[model samples]
Target: MKLNVLYFAWVRERIGVASETVETDAGSINELLDELSAREERYAIAFSDRSVLRCAIDQTLVPFETSLANATEVAFFPPMTGG
Candidate 1:
């Protein structure tokens, strides 16, 4: 499936792009991350610390184990602070 993946804040900085369309066969968000992490050194660096990452599928926040079935968008970012 093709997914429109979004990166926010430092994720964008490290990956050198804010967003991109990715063709993936990942069944879940965690698997997707693993796929991207293997793409290049920059991707590995951007997603190095999974603990600091938060994800949302199609705008609604979801856990990494969430399935990607029928999902067209996925976003990754750091946890938000109280501000």
Candidate 2:
């Protein structure tokens, strides 16, 4: 399926793009991350530490195990902080 993958803040810098359209055979967010991690060195680095990452499917925050079926967008961003 085709998915609109979005990157924010440092995630975008690490990935080298703000967003991209990708064709993936992944069933869930974690699976997609696994596949992306295998695509290249940068991708591996960006996803190297999952603890620093957060996700949203079609704009709704979700867990990594969330299903990706019928989803049109997936966003990855760093953990937020506030003072």
Candidate 3:
């Protein structure tokens, strides 16, 4: 499937792009991340700690295990903090 992967904040800085269209055969978010991490050192660095990251599928927050079937957009960002 084709997915639009979006990166935010430090995630974008590390990856060096705000978003990209990716072709993947991943069944879940974790699988997609693994594929990306294996692509280059930058991706590995950006996704190094899954615990500090947040994800949304087509704008709806979801767990890493969430199925990616029929999903077009996937966003990765840091957890928001209130000041």
Candidate 4:
């Protein structure tokens, strides 16, 4: 399946891209993360801390274990704080 992966905040800085299209066979967000983290050193660094990350599939917030069935997009970012 093809997924449009989106990065924000520090994640974008770490990975050096805001977004990219990736071909993956992952069944869930966690699985997709594993695939990405293994791709290169940058990816590994970007996803190194799962506890500080939040995921949203198709614009809806979901858990890491959430299934990726029929999903076209996946977004990863850190929690927000008041400015």
TM-score of each: 0.98, 0.96, 0.98, 0.96
User: Order the candidates by lDDT, highest first — what do you get?
Assistant: 3, 1, 2, 4
**Over all chains combined, what TM-score does candidate 4 have?**
0.96
Off by over 4 Å in 3: none
In candidate 1, the residue pairs with backbone N, CA or C atoms under 3 Å apart (3 or more residues apart, or in different chains) clash, namely none
Candidate 4: which stretches are off by over 4 Å?
none
RMSD for all candidates, in order, please.
Answer: 0.5, 0.8, 0.5, 0.8
User: Candidate 2: lDDT of 78?
Assistant: 93
| Candidate 1 least-lDDT 10 residues | 46-55
The per-model lDDT (C-alpha) reads: 0.98, 0.97, 0.99, 0.96
lDDT of 4 by residue, 50-77 (tens): 9999999999999999999999999999
Tens digit of per-residue lDDT, candidate 3, span 1-83: 99999999999999999999999999999999999999999999999999999999999999999999989999999998999
Q: Which 10-residue span in candidate 2 carries the lowest summed lDDT?
A: 74-83
Tell me, by lDDT, which candidate is best: 3
lDDT of 4 at 33: 96
lDDT of 1 by residue, 25-62 (tens): 99999999999999999999999999999999999999
- Per-residue lDDT tens digits for candidate 2, residues 1-83, read 99999999999999899999999999999999999999999999999999999999999999999999999999999988998
> Which pairs of residues clash in candidate 2, taking residues 3 or more apart in a chain or in different chains?
none
Quality of model 2 by C-alpha lDDT:
0.97
